[model samples]
Target: MTARDEILGRVRKGVGKGDFAQRKIDAQAWLTARTRGPQPALAGDLLERFRNKAESLSSTVEAVADRGAVPAAVARYLAAQNLGTEVVMTPDVAALNWIAHGVRGTARAAADADRVGVTACFCAVAETGTLMLLSAPDSPATVSLLPETHIALVDASRVVATMEDAFALLRAERGEIPRAINFVSGPSRTGDIEQTIVLGAHGPCRVHLILIGTSS
Candidate 1:
């Protein structure tokens, strides 16, 4: 037998494996059930809670009317921050005419020197002020990680009351998980040295969120 097969056989023998096909069927059934554990009681409006929590985490947030207005809002933010007009964005928002707003958009993974990276979040958790991002062909993980500034476009409708709710939505929509799932709580910070918090230690120093839709 091949080395891989031999190793697997030994492992199965030690573990006393039954029908592998049956085990896979069981796992699929468990996933489809969408079972959830206990979650904290989140009071008040979910959107308001999300905003408050995100702000507390030092993430800048803006409420825009709709998706059509996102490009203009993003442009305004970049100008106000004195950032450049060129930005790396995800393929999901490629159709938007960013050039009209004086911002050149490139749909690809972020590079080390990239100043700004824009992406649409899969969902936001209100309880912890966390952004749920699932890496896919259109949404790359590097867009939110390898940039000085990470700008996220989140639909207010996708904001969940808790982390549990977010996972439920993911299971319902995706059925299977993607290669990478990122939960961004705030700007990357580290207090390892002298217990002094330093931003951009491992990732973006700034995280800006543009909330869209009527609920926003």
Candidate 2:
């Protein structure tokens, strides 16, 4: 038989044996964490330090206080990159006035090459310095993935301590249901074979984050 058939036959045989219980327990243990520790005070100092560190690691890092607070930052970025008004706007971004900045927003279903993609983040992690996006009705999954340049507006209030914290928040909101959740760390990068890091391998080459901070 062919290699594919052999693999399928092995899978079928494995299923027939019903060896799923052990694996399930192992998976649960891997995901579940039981910990008791003192919670550190999350303050502006901490966030600024985190932002500084992230900037040091990454060549590109932009920060803002609120969603509405930084329309000029968006304009500056677009002007610097020379992106036009034809931008693919996701419904998730409610605060930013795209038209005011001379940007044409579009629904997720009808995004095209001419349009730059705009989307909102469900949560931003301060630990790994990543942005988390969930595939909800307003935040269509494609906006973050398809465009040549992706501009994400992250509210500082939504920024969490760690990836574990983000997961906890997600579990509280989503429950046990499995859905498309993307965790983007910087832009899309690949350093395979030749070992030279290259950006925009399968996704957007440029990822500009607008960190929108707010009072708690």
What's the C-alpha lDDT at position 151 in model 2?
Answer: 81
lDDT of 1 by residue, 1-216 (tens): 899999999988776585788778877887778766787899998889999999999899999889999999999999999998999999998898898899999999889888999999999999999999999999999999999999999899999998878887997899888899999988999999999999899999999999998545
**Residue pairs of candidate 2 with colliding backbone atoms:** 65-213, 87-116
Candidate 2: Cα lDDT at 127 = 62
After superposition, candidate 2 runs with Cα above 4 Å error: 1-44, 56-59, 110-115, 176-178, 214-216
Best-matching candidate per lDDT: 1
lDDT of 2 by residue, 1-216 (tens): 999988998987776544577777766787676663565556565456446545543525577766765566777788889986667767767456767876666666434464467788888777666888888788888888888788888777777887778888887987764478898777787899599988888887788877777432
Write down the worst ten-residue block by lDDT for model 1: 13-22
TM-score of each: 0.90, 0.73
Query: Best by TM-score, which number?
Result: 1
Per-residue error at 133 for model 2, in Å? 0.8
